[model samples]
Target chain A: MSQKMTRRRLLLGGAATAAVAMVKSSFGKMVQTGIPEAAMDPTRQVGPLPGVLGTRSPFEHPQRKASLTSSQTPLQDLYGIITPSDLHFERHHAGVPAIDPNTYELTIHGMVDRPTVFSLADLKRFPAVSRICFIECSGNFRKPDKETITPQDICGLTSQSEWTGVMLSTIFREVGVDPKATWFLAEGSDAAVMTRSIPVSKGWDDAMIVYAQNGEAIRPQQGYPARLLLPGWEGNTSIKWLRRIELSDGPFMTREETSKYTEPIKDGKIRQFSFTMDARSIITYPAYPVQLQKGWVEIRGIAWSGRGKITGVEISTNAGKSWQAARLQEPVMDKAHTCFRYLWQWDGDTTEIMSRAIDETGYIQPSLKELITARGIGTGYHLNPVTAWLIKRGGEVVYRPEKWK
Target chain B: MPYWACVAGIAMISCERRVNTAPTHFGYGRPATKQEIAAKAIAIRPDGKGLPAGSGTVQHGAVIYAGKCASCHGVTGTEGPFNVLVAPDTADAVPFDRAPQRIKAIGNYWPYATTVFDYVRRAMPFNAPGSLSDNEVYSLTAYLLYANKLIDSSTVMNAKTLPGVIMPARKYYVTDNRNGGDGPYE
Candidate 1:
């Protein structure tokens, strides 16, 4: 026999006012935000009339946790790969500047045959290409020494989006970039005037001047008029609110490059220009704050690598004693987040579930213990360790926090 | 008709290797003027290529620090409402990578003195950034250097003497050597 269905007829081709009034009389106002939104019965009601802009359902609320310098995406609440534009992670030294497209201009000068200034209109006129990729902050890891934490609280700085823009190499060719120019300084228009010196080879290789994100104009939090998009690098190198490009022979050694972003490694050395984010994977479903029921369960997560495509992800249901390959979703693009899923029959035993990703370059994500043995305890940036989620017998889930000295 | 068909057939044959038809230049932007380039080129390198002509003394810097910077960075630069700016009992002698607990302040971790001026000029005071004059920036730089015990109290900081001050952490810096493979992490 077929499953039972709701008995209400589907409403169509009628004025929304009559349906809204009828629903309001029965249910009384549900939401008090002036629009009588969500004031309808769940099983049967006429939805709001079509408006100019779309809004998310009143039942769902996914938001980014913000601080003074940065904000983290709601990774646990998110599903699939592409992050919503407004919900994408943001990190600004000063603050997002309100730029008018008519007055905004990006100037490319120094070590070029022709120095030129391109307005937003000028950049849009060039050939545009779109691709999906992830931009992760170098300081993404937070070893706060606590067991109670969510994925957003642990590592929410990584976000993926489909960006549309003209390739920076196209503009480089138009300006006649000099062969001797090895480095270029990219600067922002914010109050900090953030600057970073990137290698010139990245321009010829997949760098883009992106202006649109996820099928719409880019949000001001991610750069409104334009921002630099360096695929497979740390997010800061992809400077937002891009204003200037100055080609040169050497690194500018700005305050960002020398004092702040650089991380200390083993021995007496400090690592400069560590751009690529390594392979990382975190189980989002069984993570903290989500209660589990012991039965036939499906574990799901996202895996990504800055160097190349994620080849495979291994799930360890019985802790680190053994591992099995999880099934990968189709159309796994290069340098983009790929979703993976695995099926397991939980025997109501308290155990830890974990995931580790392997990139196309055969670099496997290391454990926190293995990372500490190699890079020592002092290294801070680019911390991409395999994360584990602990499941309790009473149907409680929590993050498996690693101890760092 | 046969002649035209033969020409079309030849065109199809020529498409075997997908001949490159992309233009070398699309010419989308206008030439930038000298004035516009000068207005936005604000990055200052370690070799001191962009410092404006200004001089400041440590005496005047103390007064300016009390008025503008003391609210955020503390009056003595060591006690911080935010970031501690001064050195605490010669913390530079401790190797930061080896010692995990050492706090990174301007007195220990920064590799160049020019960065101090460059950062203050671009973003500082924590409230109203980019509001300090060049002379006031130089003065604050002098006061901070003196507070960190890197410079003498009588020294005058200008574009010339500022770059010459050697930071202790300069020699410890190295380029990133990490290459992704099955090898050990760098």
Candidate 2:
């Protein structure tokens, strides 16, 4: 790895190179006008050196806003679906545990004919699989705040990663799960000893025991050594620092399931174990804190769902009154973020623009009013209302606030 | 000669191409092992499989509750500035839109008795969690059940007997079936 050049250093180098070029080009009108002199000065540069550890570009910096319990992602600065491993959102109860990979173990016991304990090495030795999926917190929405708040602040508790791990069914087969068992309790090794009861059907499906993210060992903030990966499910269900899985006949109804994850619906009935996230989208560029131009502008954003593919994403320039389908970037994936773009002819008028996601299930993303009317104001979790960006005639963009009551 | 020098400089600049080489070494450690995995598998399931061996009566549980839990949860587990732990079985009553002005106790909302034991043992007592012994937890579970009128005051709870008691809120709880198609549920 080479020493990353900071913006200040690059600017200084550019100035010195310009002075040298000026001296060299006295007779002719400096033939090389656009190209920087640094491109011509070979002797001034150093060769590639090895042995340097991982690092980010000194000129660029993306960071998370850390508080007592959770950290918000910087969604405004990101350009793609894959979040850098370091910038992934975090929400841990009782703080992250420092587990030595050598000492870490995953035990599969209870209601199984063959109880088994898998060392970290044992899990890696099995057939490994990798898939890209998003893990979003059950409580990921916020009230309309100041214009400085990015999409990350609005719903940054969600993130996507190319997770590499053994299929959970491989471990389940090794343990020989009992046929009668319907649910399994997944417990974490954190200080709070976080735990949730997941259905057995999920274990046999797309669930994974992931150990790596983004082509490297998982970041400590994203469950260092190993974590459960329930594709497209609520983030809480994917327990980090995973240590135990016990098969059983019924749900554990843990504190998280009964008191926390459960959301109240239209009637008096509370929606418990509401796991999968509905389809949703957000405009990345020309959003809050980004100024727009008057003429033709290209709008880019991401759309995704837990149910299936994002078949279509509709953009509304007049606060969802008129809808036009945005061009879906090719190779749209299931339970993974799909990039979408729209070429809009901006007339420089003050207008509210928003995007609504329609998944393969044909379920249209609800507006804030529709969501409140359906779920009621008392419930705060699972809030996925379509987000609106208010673009001013002066080329400034701001978030449009939606009142609950 | 100057033209040749300019061509050589362009060649050197173009040669600075980024390589797609495989990472020969990693900065982080390797994966976790089976023995390490076994040291922490303490979760209990609904089928009474992972439950530890212990037994306690409603009478014994009442004493433990008074000594350890009554401060925050209130006497008899009814009053609370926090969550309520006991109530009469009202499976048929409509749930309040807001968390009721009165306490919506565990008997009214909790769907499984196994959860009551699993939760109390894992995180409870407000200030301290994982402090109660298995026997003590079992006794408190029985006491709460008795108070909620689900079990008799004389009932004893253990690994076997604890899962057998039916919960009032069990019928209302349904598995998520939202992925298949469009409806109020899916």
Candidate 3:
């Protein structure tokens, strides 16, 4: 379906060129092709136009996957780490509620010296900060054999963006946080009225109250007016459509933290508040359903860690026995996706290839066996084990799934 | 000429004002009410502030456990092929890498006791969710606590008693103090 759409766009561009040629011949010397006639000219075409109401690209059209809960980005077609503003992955508990900007207000109360409510305009008046980071769902891992699955299916839940917003510390200062306040409750304005208890230290450390993503006002799906941004934490912690913040002495233990996000560990002990994502790597190119020729194969993939920067990534051609370091792309930012590549000569022998990430904290990517041994085999969330792809003699590549049991 | 120029400038200003008008207010619904807020604020804190008022004895919980929970969690809570919910308090002495031993129940790894009632009432029994009455949930909490030796077999568990039980693993769990300035850990 995507290939068909790309072909149609190319055909439209050709047709537009032919139409321009026809118009040029009809007008002859009286009408210039570069400049519009004075009678029909709207902006005079001499300087920048004053203003425009609506916009649509003459060449391209990109859309989101709409469903009951979440809409996904087109991951298979993206090139870089930063997802386009319109293509950011979206997950809302209730439907996207329409908010009137003038009436939108954020209240900060409870365990604060000065409880205050700030309007949307008031938030923008503060000094702004920008940072690039990736937000990923806790349940993003999926199996490979399903050919119907696009890159969206494998890991579309994760997307990177340059977010512009006010630092949460700035708001905390305005409200004057009480000394006893240890946790904060961030609530959204949606019908579900989603809420989560965030540690107060995170606000002082690196949290942001963002109103923009990828250089534009944030899209409605990515939290239009304003949202919380917790760099390197789980996506849900960055609450969307934010409305209220209440500081407290302890965690609120919301339904999300207790019944949902928490995963049972080995034995009967359930692990809660496990927010930071461990180091992980995945091969994007020459993956399932993409056939390769027996020649120089440029292995391309992405590596990231919520803890910090990705120190190194190693590729294994013969399962887990041997490994070779892959080249990292330039300007590898912290808490952001770093692209990696390896030039390999493929003789097309049946072999399995895999990639593993090592973060700055010296935490090595664990194998499936190691993961299962540590966390037990009951729960299925936050599975970031090294992924492998099997290449047949015929040059067809397939995903090699590791059995859970 | 000066008066004429002033009149022309005023006309231009009026023309610009006709093109745009700033809105004074936005039409949105009223703020959420206190009752609406209370209905959804069903979270059990570590200090047990939101715990419901009900009590259950271990003897009553044993009967309920044998009928409903015993199939999946085991009869005595130690015979689980699924998840073992109970463990001997002395089992913490065993090393993690040693030979396979009894399952590490809530007594060994959980940092807070309030989490047990909070989790079970929300998503337990594998099939039915939120089916257990408040008394039944309290009973189940009592049974699990008594089985793990955190409480006596004859003890009754309610809102007041459940939060007071100290978990053995509370001391081991530590806050993640990682920051980007000094790497991920201290």
Specify the highest-TM-score model's number.
Answer: 1
TM-score result, candidate 1: 0.91
Q: Which candidate ranks first by DockQ, i.e. highest?
A: 1
lDDT of 3 by residue, A66-118 (tens): 55567777665667688887678888775677888788877777787666677
| Candidate 1 structure lDDT | 0.84
Per-residue lDDT tens digits for candidate 3, residues B72-171, read 8888987876678886554355432232343456776566678778767755665565678878888988888888888898788888988899887665
Q: Residue A353's C-alpha lDDT in candidate 3?
A: 82
TM-score of chain A of each: 0.91, 0.88, 0.85
Candidate 3: clashing pairs of residues: none
Docking quality level of the chain pair in candidate 1: medium
lDDT, candidate 1, A141-161, per-residue tens: 988577688888778999999
Worst 10 residues of 1 chain B by lDDT: B89-98
True contacts kept of 1: 0.73
Candidate 1 runs further than 4 Å off? A1-39, A42-45, B1-20, B89-92
Off by over 4 Å in 2: A1-51, A143-148, B1-108, B124-129, B136-171, B180-186
**Candidate 1: clashing residue pairs, number:** 0
Query: How many angstroms is residue A230 displaced in model 1 relative to the true structure, after the best TM-score fit?
Result: 0.9
Q: Rank the candidates by DockQ, best first.
A: 1, 2, 3
Interface RMSD for each predicted structure? 1.3, 6.6, 8.0
